[model samples]
Target chain A: MPMTTAEKILAAHCGRDEVRPGEIVMADLDLALANDITAPLAIEEFRRSGAVKVRDPRRIVFVCDHFTPNKDIRSAEQVRLIRDFSREQGIENFFDVGEMGIEHALLPEKGLVLPGDLVIGADSHTCTYGALGAFATGVGSTDLAGAMLSGRAWFKVPVSMLFNYRGRPGEWTGGKDFILHTIGRIGVSGALYAAMEFAGPAIHALSMDDRFSMANMSIEAGAKTGIFPVDEKVEEYVRGRSGRRGRSFPADEGAEYAARFDFDVSGLEPQVALPSLPSNVRPVGEVKGVRVDQVVIGSCTNGRLEDLRAAARVLQGRKVARGVRVIIFPATQRIYLEAMREGLLEIFIEAGAAVSTPTCGPCLGGHMGILAEGERAVATTNRNFVGRMGHPRSEVYLAGPYVAAASAVAGEIIHPARVAGGDRPGEEN
Target chain B: MKIQGRAWKFGDDVDTDAIIAARYLNPTDPAELGACLMEDIRPGFACEDVRGGIIVAGANFGCGSSREHAPVAIRGAGVRAVVAESFARIFFRNAFNTGLPIFESADAAKGIVEGDEIEIDASEGLIRNLSRNETYRSQPVPPFMRELIASGGLLSYMMKNLNQEGKKK
Candidate 1:
């Protein structure tokens, strides 16, 4: 039987040759992850399950990215809870402060999850791995706990949607613009209970980092996951990280799809999602003059090394505007080191932006650079929900790295094209 | 299961952040989590006559983040059930896992007004507005998942299944 990539991956993991959408299958997981905030509750359920030992210690992973380095007393306790459970269980992948990066980014970077794998996590952005051709989705804490005991979890296979990208994006527009435009076209719940498959030449043209950004925000579109089919680019990335590239599951020819969309992104402009909703998207030209108090350039969505390079390109020879506070967070410690070595960190610091140690700070209002009440920010992070970054009255505008960096320099939401890229050189960060 | 409560109405795409802000996610006590329920969206929402209430919201309720905190806070606040036109994926599963009954019915979501006395018969998928004298039916939980809800999600199943496997080993 013909199957979509997601369906085929799930089917293979379940020891079946074929599976259909909406059919429940119990599939083995290549990996399962939980962060500090989620692990504590999952641990509680793990103990309540009356199981003293996990099904596979090697497969269970814990990362202390949220509230890492001990944000507060309770946050400290949350990490300690997971740390102790991991130690006792002999789980090999417990990532503490110095070793910790955002779990989704860290996992792919370390080659812990490979192509065509089936993965799950207690956090929603687990769908980020789908960028690498893996089948992944978020599960509740209880489901995580159940998977810990059984090494398997039930899944209701999702119908797949094919989003065929036909043309390349314009300058200053990339995968982030594509996804923001998609969400704007389709509401927040547009892909609810569906797998989003991106293909065609334009999708292949995107860098792996760009693909990661697109897949990371799939949850914002209400998708179970978003995936790009494996190709030479995928093989190259996996081969660079690990000798073994695992396996690849490509959708069969004439595979079934619930719906299909063709997006020609070559003419697309830089997009920004306005305050309070990721779906409230408009061209950068639409809301150009709205002044912002802060600018954040980081998160699992766009916090890769390439994101830093993009921001650095826009920040070179341009100082951050007088009153705007700019903060940049590299997604992982390795990315931090790479940025430091490449002078990206120096450029940001010279530009008046604080380059913090890798953490998810300020993105989920966890810490580091929270916005005050009545404040507005332009951020490269994923969601812009009301009060997401800080005070309920504070606002966040979601944009790509180029636009966010340009906004920092302009002190307002503006197109990168509107601001000269460091034409006047002197003390430009 | 029959749950009786007054209706609390909300608009569409009511995200998890609006349901419970990230700042209030800590300290894991149910009551503590409930204390600031929807405080971002409506100040003093927890202070309202919300106990024993059913939440009726427009389409795409619980649209962002798979934070189980969203449903936990609502269930902890003593909200009996949620009736929505539709729901985002993870929150729907989180609701069942946490034993917080949620239903999908465009009719119930649109017709039920705020503060209306409502009763939900979940097994039969019936939602009736006592104050408005109207009735609506929600899509029933899938057959296999019904067994999950009956066990209050994973508490019984995981506990029993793992324990039995332990003894066998």
Candidate 2:
């Protein structure tokens, strides 16, 4: 039987072939993880299993990325609990803020993940690893608790949604806009319980980082996992990063996809998701001239050095609007250090953007960049659900880093390509 | 193993936050949980209906957050079985490990309306829609999962069996 990338991964992991959608499969987990935010509950549930020792401590990684810098006493206590648990459990793979970055970036950049592995994390963006051909997805704290206890979790194979993107993106359009536009068309929860397989020329031309950005937002559309077939681009990235090489796996020719969508990338533009939902999106041009109170260019969604550099390039020698507080937090410490080393930090600071430490700060309202009642902010984070970051009355506008940076300068939603700068307006620089 | 009850149905994408939002993550009250299940997304899903029956849902049911509270809330609200066209990867396993019977029927939510009487044969993973006079086959419960539910849950089963082995020594 012809199998999609998802089916191939699940089958290989579970030691089965031709697994049916909606059928429970006892797949082996390649990697399991929890972070400070979810680790406390997971540890509690692990203890409830009554096991004197973890099934395999080495397989687990504990990251302190969500509320880094000890935002509050409660957060500090939570981090302390995780530290104690790691030390007590003898899990030396513990990563505190100093050593950690965003959970998804830290994992792959550190060579902890490889192709065809089935990994799980406590954060929804865990699906980001699928860019490298892994079937990685998120779980709740309790489900993570169960995995830590038993080392395995059950699954119902999902149906598949195949997205075919052809041609290149329009000027000023980046990976962020691609995903936003796709979600806008499909709506939030459109790919519910289905694996999204991204294929076609446009997808093939995208860099590994771009693909990572694409797969990362699958959960926003409620997909089980988003995947891409392993190819030379992925192989080159992984091999260069870790000095590790692995074979690529593409779907067998003519693999069956439950549903397919074809898009012309050149027609797409910078997209923005309005408040309260990821699906509430419109072309950036349509929403242009709208004002913003703050601009956040961070989170696991778009906090890499390239992403920061993209924003920095837009903000250089420009001042943020008087009332706009622009904050830029890199996804991981490594990315932050890289940005600093590359002098992007200087540009950000000179542009009057607050360059916070690496953490999931303000992404989930854990710390930093939170808005008050009737407040509004433009963010590069994933979800803009009501009360997600702070007060229920606060609204978050989701946009690409470039657009966010431009808006930080204009104090309204504007295309960075449109700004008077080095790159041409709407240029694919 | 057999599970018989009335039925409660939900649509797709019943997220973790909806099952139990992040604000209430710290609580231990499962009873209080039943009231809030689907409160944000489905408003009245857990309260007015969904008593003493199976839950049938469309594709991608229980898709978001892996909070086991979702299944806990369902079971706590007196649900016996969850029948869905498909389930999110983690939620699927969480239900079984916690002793909540979840069955998958491709026609999962078809013709099985809100107030249907249903009987589930866990051994065969079959659902008999008594109200619709239709019988459907579900995804088979694996052997280990059967043992888990039979022993009342993963923790209980492990405690009883493993602790007994210690006494045998």
Candidate 3:
């Protein structure tokens, strides 16, 4: 039978000839991940299960990113519990504070997740690896415990939704804009329990970073996972990072999709999700001039090197507006060092933006760059749910780095194209 | 498989963050987490009103974030069962894994009002609204899932199976 990429991967992992949507299967995992917040509970469950050892210590990864560098005494205690458990279990993939990055970003860079792999994490953004063609999804900590004890997790095969995009994106428009637009069209619950597959010409043209950003936000639309078919770009990225040829499972011609959406991106504009829900999206042009007190340009969604470079291009030779706090965070230490070596760090610092270490940080309201009460922020993060970044009264507008950087300079939300040719601070006079 | 309680009402899209804020996620103890359940939106819900009640909510209850804390907090706060128009997928799985019973009944969601006395026969998937004297039907809980809940959750279920296998060996 013809199958989508997700179905192909799940069938292979479950040792079945074929699996269809809605079929429950227990599949072996290629990778299992947990971070500070989820790991403590998973560890407690593992101990209670009387599992003397994890199924495969090498396949499990423990990353301490969220609340790391411990926000408070309780956070400190949580991290300690994870560290101790990793050591006791002799888990080879444990990443401590200095070595840690956001798990989604770090796992791919470390070559831990490969195309056609079945992965699960306690973090919702585990679906991010679907950018590389992996069948990945999030589960609760007890499920993680089951995966740890048995190296297997259960899944209900999800019906597939195909999104076909044609035409190239306009300047200042990238993955974040594309995803926000998609979410706006399909409300938050539109794709409930379905795998979303990106296809067609425009998807083939997107860089891996763009694909990652797009796939990372699939959960915001309540998708089971978002995936892009493996192509030359994914092959090139995987080969460069792992020194191994990338593998791909293409959807069979005429494979049935539960639903299909077609988009033409030729005239796409930058998009910003309004406060309280990721589905509340508007074009930057429509919402321009809305004042903001903070601008944040980083998260698992948009904190890659390419995202920083885009922000740097916008912030170059400009200063952040007075009374607006601009903050930048690289997704990982590797990306941070690359930005530093490329002078992107200097550009941000000279522009008066504070660059912080690669933690989930303000994106999750964990620490750093938290918004004050009633403050408004334009951010490159994923969700804009109430109190997502500190005070419940504070508002967050989700945008790409281009919009975030431009908004930081203007002290309000503005499209980057509107400021692209404007005078720089020193050149104005 | 049977529960009787007063109904506390909520609207649609009550996300996991609203059910339990991230600020109180530091502790893993269910009781500690329970104390803060719905504190952000309902303020005193956990302490004053969450005792042995049924949550009757509109569509897409427990949306956003795959935090098991949402179900654990609900179960810990003495919520008997959650009857909603629908449930987000992850939360549905987490609820069963934590031994928290949940039912989906659009009719019950629309017909039941706040503080109405309600009884649920999960095995039969029937909800009786004592206040209105009306009965609503939902998808019956599958036998396997009822077994998991009867064992007090997935962990206990797995342990029981393990012990039975040991006896057979």
Identify the leading candidate in terms of DockQ. Answer: 1
Worst 10 residues of 2 chain A by lDDT: A420-429
Model 2 lDDT tens row, A217-328: 9988888789887888877667756544554557777887788999898767788999777888988877856788888998777888778888987888888889999888
Ranking by TM-score: 1, 3, 2
Off by over 4 Å in 1: A243-245, A421-429, B159-169
lDDT scores in order: 0.88, 0.77, 0.87
Model 1: lDDT to the true structure = 0.88
DockQ of 3: 0.58
Please give, for residues A1-429, the per-residue lDDT of candidate 3 as tens digits: 899988988998999989999877878888899998888888888888777788788889999888877899999998889888888888988888778888899999888888888999998888899999988898888888888887788788999999999997777889888899999999888888899999999988888999999999888888889988888777767775664444688899888899999999887888999988999999888894589999999888999999999999999999999999999989889999999999999999999999998888788787888888899999999988888888878899999999899999989998787677542222132
TM-score of every candidate: 0.97, 0.82, 0.96
Off by over 4 Å in 2: A240-245, A420-429, B1-64, B68-148, B154-169
Q: Whole-model lDDT, candidate 3?
A: 0.87
Output per-candidate TM-scores for chain A, rounded to 2 decimals: 0.97, 0.95, 0.97
Q: Please give the distance, in angstroms, between residue A275's alpha carbon in candidate 1 and its true position after superposition.
A: 1.4
List, in the given order, the native-contact fraction of each candidate.
Answer: 0.74, 0.20, 0.37
| lDDT (Cα, tens digit) per residue for candidate 1, span B16-115 | 8899888877667778898889988889889658988988999889988777888999988888899999999899888888888899999999899898
**Candidate 1 clash pair list:** A318-A428, A351-A429
